[model samples]
Target: MLTVILYHVIFVIVVYTDTGPPYNAFPQKLNFYYFSLYVIPSTTCFFIVLLSTIFLVVKVRRNQRWRKGTSTQTAKTNDKEDKLVRTIIAISTIFIICSFPTVSIFITQIIHKQFRYRDPYLGTLLLLMFNIGGVFQAISSSVNIFFYYRMSSRFKKVFASLFACRRSGIQGTKPSD
Candidate 1:
């Protein structure tokens, strides 16, 4: 986590220095740096999450098979595990769907230098795509709460309590001694 924070800090510093005042346009020279820092790390993290989820699902299935004739307690535990695995898969799928546009833009930019926000013809389209991607990214970051609330009873209770109205006392008065 520290390394990830440090890596992003370095990226911010580099981009800030490269862009100078106003920072209207990114330095084309740093395209490779952007690709290496942002694209590669994000892609790697996505794949890692995907692969780990797959392994977890396989392990859970294997356990379920072995515990087929186990006690009711084990069955309940397996049901919880199944919900968790499903939640993870849903989250991973959302992440991939949301990130696709941004990743596609990055790779496209790298392959065709002419394809960017400055192009006279494609500039508007590219900007729109970028904005849509940003919206999707925001959704990806926030939508996990809904999944947890839906899939996990404990999460649902805790989440509800966070917003649940409470009556401290009648008419805002303190309780009688």
Candidate 2:
């Protein structure tokens, strides 16, 4: 899926960030460990979360696709459930959009020197923006479950049943494949 590809994209950017005549830390031995471990994993998580949100939203939207003569707009407007899904998608989209520039900026700066133009001030600023955006985005991810519950009845039912099992002290059995 695109989620996996996004991870690779960020990875490529990370590699690129170290290329050419640029900021040297990324290309240095000391930074190698942190770059390969923490930075890569965190960047992958960000892209995975983003792409998953997009996939869910697209699935919801696809369900409301217009038939030959039916009105897509009408369905969204008239149906409360679709409207709720639309809202969830909208909120998720906004969060993803707001964070993308920051994420990309940091990735670009890390992998490419052109973004910072070798200026320490610009480097500090990009890093600051990326860190701040990531913190806020983490909060947004945490709230996604509530939105899913409100927007998708299937999700709500599964969540309820899972909690119900815990309340009853019953270990839920997995279904046979």
Candidate 3:
């Protein structure tokens, strides 16, 4: 929950920072090549994370049932359902934390007045790391189902119940009391 909020705040900061006239004017003034790789790819990752995380979470919940009057923290002891929920949480966490740095970098450029941009070589290296991290975040979001399989007990129970119900109905058998 906090992670989600933190990511949202960082995302907004990234957008408004460095994107404005001052930072924009610098590159036009200095023509620094280092800013190219760092700023572009890092910024790109931020947006990709924003889009993909939303897509992943929405898709997970689209047809899923939420048990009324139940706390999500309580696992169903069914490994599958628990794994699913845990995967969702883990993926969400990864997306949020991963997005922070790239966005923060943009924000830093906007805030630090004296530096006049750090060394081009160092900046390029940092930016590359930022972009790579973002790629990992994307991959994490995409492959989260595998994590869910390994960790969530509640996910298992719910999934089993759903499948069991479906199978019973197909056979025209009475549901267990």
Best by TM-score: 1
lDDT of 3: 0.60
lDDT against the true structure, per candidate, is 0.79, 0.65, 0.60
lDDT of 1 at 10: 89
- Maximum-lDDT candidate: 1
lDDT of 1 by residue, 65-168 (tens): 77775644465787787888799889988988898888888778778888866789888988999899999999999998888889989888887676553543
Q: Which of 1 and 2 is ahead in TM-score?
A: 1
TM-scores of the models, in the order given: 0.76, 0.50, 0.38
TM-score of 2: 0.50
Candidate 1: global Cα-lDDT? 0.79
lDDT for 155 in candidate 1 is 85
| Model 2 steric clash pairs | 16-111, 17-111, 17-112
Q: Rank the candidates by lDDT, best first.
A: 1, 2, 3
Give every collision pair in model 1. none
